[model samples]
Target: MIGSKRWCGVAVFLVLLMAGTHVGIGAESLFRHFVKAKGDCLVDGDQPLRFVSFNIPNLLLIEDDMEFVRTNPWRLPVEYEIEDALRAVVQAGGTVARTYTISVAREDDDPGTPKHVLAPGRFNEEAFRAMDLVLAVANRVGVRLLVPLVDNWKWMGGRPQYAAFRGKSPDDFWTDPQLREDFKKTIAFVLNRVNTVTGVRYRDDKAILAWELGNELQQCPREWAEEMASYIKQLDPNHLVAGGVQTHELHDWELESRVIDLVSTHHYEGDPMRMAANIRAAAERARGKKPYYIGEFGFVSAGGIRYVLDRVVRTPNIAGALIWSLRFHNRDGGFYWHSEPAGNRLYRAYHWPGFESGDAYAERAVLGFLRSAAFAIRGLAPPPVEKPDPPHLLPIPDVGHISWRGSVGAYAYVVERAESPQGPWQVVGRWVDDAAVSYASLFSDESAQIGRKYFYRVRALNEAGISAPSNIEGPVTVAELSFVDEFADLQRVFQMGGQVSLGALGARAFKEDLHRLEMSEGAWVRYWVPGEIREVEIRAFGQTDSLSLELAVSADGQEYGPVPVVQRGFRMNGRDYPYRVPVLVSGRIDRPGCHFLQLKAAGALQLGRVEIRYE
Candidate 1:
């Protein structure tokens, strides 16, 4: 009888353990609160919730042939990738992530690739399972998600695919009754389906902070957005609903709608004051009826980011801001989106852990600002806001002197000097004044040797701490100009034609530490040559047999003629990773006094530093 009792006890214990595992008991223990919208702010239980989030469009979709996905099919190992991305967000002091499109199209038709939506009304169990892992991992990692249900663009098999599936135009999908019904069915199918990995229905899942109707639905009528938002709310009242509209599309009635929980807007403006003014106007229009979120905002300048973020945190009605994106180092051994569109070309990808090589924006300063703003929005102590704008270094001709713009609100400024653009910089001067709002900061390194290159950067300092180092300016050499474009700052100098972009250097070069100009076939870079020229040396990196390029010298920017080129290949440590084979192309400009020098890629190649040996 005692032996029988022991067997029964063991069975009971096993049953309980199985039940706990199914419900994600371990993950549930970590996050005990569910996020809810209360007035204009999101709250977790009794505590008001404020978050700085990032967008990761392809979090759930995995490349089927990846080694991790192939080996761990049962466990849905792609969650590990999601975990890496989420951990980066949390580490950068971000609390939420706004994913791109969660809805995959029925017509994707790629057999080898994983499809989220296999067919109309029929979902891919494997893709759904991947989503299940995303939520499960999100809960475990303590990051909230704002999931977009569909896409405004065709890249993800969005509305266009939906319309195509039904033999209708993309616009008809919004107004046609049958298409609307079909969309509702898809929504019902997703929300009601039981998560295979989590053992919980998505409607019941608390990990999702909100449901975005669709991404940037500017073409869709406002009424359709309202209808879709309402339909989602009817299906699942647990989560908030956001109309993912651009700033221009937002209306007062939309914010006041009973179904719409938040109003989201995107901004890609360069002007900080204009960006802030738009936000303030949106907040006023919201009128505390619904929270306003800057769903997407990115700039090619650190000052621009700081300006937007500073405004966002100070505004009481604004819920939070999520930057345009964050990219992870996936199992594929590189970051995603190699073929990004031209408009999004300038936005840099922030890597996990170190978050280095971010374009234009300073990673450390941006993260620091975000962390502080997150606290401030939550009614916690304010973060230090003393980081100053980067000083612009302008070299004076014929003198070994440089002048810089003074920083606002800086108690002092520290100037540092380095031999190369990538620095082991030593402090050259310090300008200090307790009463001064700004300093007339200038330095003359008369003791420096002539003909040697010198790099200079500056930082603002106060009692709280020092700001991020300013832009690295110089290689101020006394040598006669051959050609010099470090490709360090391309915002104002370089002009691109055809299909070329500024990208992080895959291979390291001399003066410019991080960036390179990537050129596809027929693409070119036009540089205005200030003087009469002779020979030009181009440093480029690409596949040995694959890369072909030509140098053209033109008196007018419009027309050009190719110069004779000599190509050589060598090995070097790549900036994107390490150990890359690159090619160096050299040529003579037989014609002098050319106004423009155009570097045209005969094939796909990356142009690093361009130096012209001129007369």
Candidate 2:
């Protein structure tokens, strides 16, 4: 008899299979379709299977111990980090995820440590177990995983390590008989491995949507990719296979390959129009031959994200699009990989719940576009022709207040209020005519009681109907005698090093009243508290490790001491907010002194606002 764990796995698989059938397009079953490439589109049993996915390359690489392989035989602790990342994808209305490099190497390098490969023909059981857990979690969460077999660059010991094993150059690994056999062995090992947690073999797992031959294997000949894809198909006939090629490597043979199931392209152009145009062109090229996907796209603004998403959703042949990545604070405390600094400054992984980041634009807008597009691609009824932008809600001392940037082509706006974030919300206000103009819209709840929290959201309306609701921002308690310095008027008191600038930007903060303070190693910022302060609350956008802030206070404006505060982060509705860091220095501030506050940061930091509660 199969073990209980195995039975549970099967049970879960069946439930997911049933769920897939229920949600399948055009009243068809996804199980019956199995994501086949039909006439340049991925179809599910006569229904199109269009998807929006995110790249979480380090899903299998647990943050614990960093051991290349699990040396301990016991089940590796299931890291919630991976689940959290997957949750972000799902919450954003994504149904698929494409992970980054899964490396296999003998000796671990500092930057690229934790190689999954112990040696040629020898495999790391621990690393394999981690992947097993990933699939198990993916199954439970109902998100499909598209796993790439190997990397092309040395970052993951792809081609170079294969050659290094047999004393050959990276180029020779493609043609060398021994290297080719070694690669095949690796493929077999992965394809046949049984999951220790779920008790299901990798080949039989339905959670896996596709098997990628390799990531960006441009240096390798088309024949190599075709051969690897064929090899994978032979081992696991159930899942689809992709070459993972970009536009540059789009050869006719590769597109026409019988084994390859999908054609993928990567784009990172700065211009939104150009990126959309490129995707359109690629989709046109792949039409009627194979399904097309923008496998990777990033380093663009929120508008760029919208532009590209619009193009992909409108294209009939394109299967879907996956952003470059999504990062979780619990994983390595922050972004665990190298991202373009410029992109980092503009856009990072779409954080869970809050969706706000240090990026130049609000991710709420991007998420709205993505969620709508995802629905549209899956053959769901299209969302309103235009959705209202997320409203910005702030607590004005002794008053109820909310504001929002206006939506284009919207004739009216509706503001909704609720007692709780997840709530039975009621419409509070509706504005039209001059009131609905962009950046000129504002609402004040005159009856909102002081000291009581409230939540607010906004939606735009046109001739068609009401758009999707904006980002919910509240539970903001109206306070008495609270001095709020939105950082809009504050001058840079001190900038030790790194880039620091203040601006009224980001949808999460008060209108045009946020600051972007970039810090390097050993960098710090000092600000003067406006009045006698009892407590201080700092609002900012940050990932756990990538950007963190330390607050210090001084009575004489000279000697500073660390302030005690508990930093609490939260996720709601597919966005993350590290908002609960409050410094209660009542005694110090009540002493008729303590005027200056200093912030010291170890890693990159973005300072948003500083609020002081006083007598």
Candidate 3:
């Protein structure tokens, strides 16, 4: 699996190309079709408006963590990776995915100041390459993109003069004339770059959503905010621009007032309804300036999703919402529940019935609302979003075992499996309620032989009507499977050291023994070996005393137990030892599922060589 960091770099690059082109259609052509077709306002056609967002730990751009990039290196591979990540969203029904990238001005060469963000566009090869890849990916996947270019990277782009007026203070960065020029240039570079994703050079894609100027501008001086907002409007008239305002900060509104095309807020509090109300009031009080949206909002419980949607949908002028993130880390003390795909929950609930997550209530409630909304949005409706044909549908969605997020009433699809598309079809599973239309039909060929082929199709029924069968995909064969496990070798030889730093020694011969011994300090090496796996082997030996060749094992890599010692009749340097025990021990690593397997020396034995082979 590719690491998330490289994926993030790809997102950053895509944001640079956001304003390249504009769609020719006006608000009437787009939104009229949507309202007539029973779709969302932004989705001017039969398709549901696809909006998705991910919280990329862009800060991790500089940090090193094995978990973030296990197989893929941090240096971006290409622009397509960004598209690849977005493709996942597309498949999940998202037409837009937001990334907190140009949240600030970025410096290319590490400008050496503590407060300066890097302006690496001029010097960083990786940064440039990653940016290029992002455009390519967005073009490939059919999703509109949004990037909040102001925050952290802003102060880095030579806008030191503007920085002086930041926060409540007015004399820090605004006084620097050179800093002001730098900031202007930085904005020009970004605004002028053509977004390859939309085909129109930096000023054209109509599908392009909004260019969020600042993530949250409590520190952004009101004057500078107005200045930048005006510049952006004059610079790119086609796209909407807004600052991703933080909670209820009126100081931000001074800047929020003039520069933004829309008022964007990130609301995720105990009560999303209450939060939405406050923001709605703020937008309304702005008079009839622009639209308002809960650009980002989500909570620890998936149930909060319902509350948020309920409030936003009821608000008169609010356009739509973009969940703060589809997936994020638990390390930051935030919830990670929104990561699930739409069809997952329903399938799980079909099997496990009452599996509750914080958002269970909301997820359950949303299905009926979506069906109602889909039916109600007549002005936006054309033909309804197209579902893939028969061969593309899963024959047996494990509905009973699905999670709540995937259990939408509208997704309940009927799956029919057959030896061939033209032959007899059998209903593998069924859910008839209008809400069931939201359930995705998932099927598998447990009986399918390795190289065997099969075909499938699905049908869904919502209040708008039953969709035509999805397109046919294959009479295709299931191919063999394999895992590259590029880091497998590195994980081995990760030894708990006896006297020296095993990491230092392993670093020298990393290619050779990366898995067996990791650098650690102790008398014995305790390496983690997974159980129920039979493709690998481990063996250890002592060169000196044969009697000291005893071995101990532990379920957890930390605590070890004694293994029966057998005396070998082999003596070294005339020592009366007769232990030449066969080192080919063939017992399974006796640990429970998901437990760690550890091997240790029995006595004060001279550690020789340990080998693992996959046959």
TM-score of every model versus the real structure: 0.59, 0.60, 0.48
Tens digit of per-residue lDDT, candidate 2, span 1-615:
125334433443354434422121122212332556777876544445678768876686632231112221112224455556665565556678888656766334443345566567788777777787677777666678788877776755687788888888888977998999998898898889888877778888877878888788776577787788888888899889987666533568767788888878888778888888788777777888888888888777777788788778777788889987664533212222222334543454554332223334565566667777766666553333433333333332333335554443344567777889898988867753212111211344544555677787777765667778877876667562343433434453533545555543332221112234445556776766445556766654455412356667778887877776656442111112112121122223434567777777665555555555543
Question: What is the TM-score of candidate 1?
Answer: 0.59
For candidate 1, lDDT tens digit of each residue in 387-446? 444444455342233455434334466778888878788886676321121011134454
Residues forming the 10-long window of minimal summed lDDT in candidate 1: 66-75
lDDT of 3 by residue, 1-615 (tens): 124323433442343234223222121111112111121133323333323333332221211111210211122323222433444344333445565544232222233222222442333434533554454455444455666655532322323324533332223433345555545655666677664333345445443466766566545665666677777778777666766544552334643364555565666554656665666675565434455455665542444555555555555455555554432211211112211223332211111111122233454343333323322222212123333222223222222111111211133455545668785866654642222211111233333334556555556543444555544435755442111111223344445445422221211111111212222223555444332222223322233424333345555556665545333322211111222221223233333332333444445332222322111
Model 3: how far residue 271 lies from native, Å: 2.9
Better of 2 and 3 by lDDT: 2
lDDT of 1 at 68: 12
Ranking by lDDT: 1, 2, 3
- How big is the positional error of residue 181 in model 1, measured in Å on the Cα after superposition? 1.7
For model 3, what is the error of residue 572's alpha carbon versus the real structure, in angstroms, after optimal superposition? 44
Work out candidate 2's RMSD over C-alphas.
12.2
Residue 566 of model 2, lDDT score: 53
The candidate scoring highest on lDDT is 1
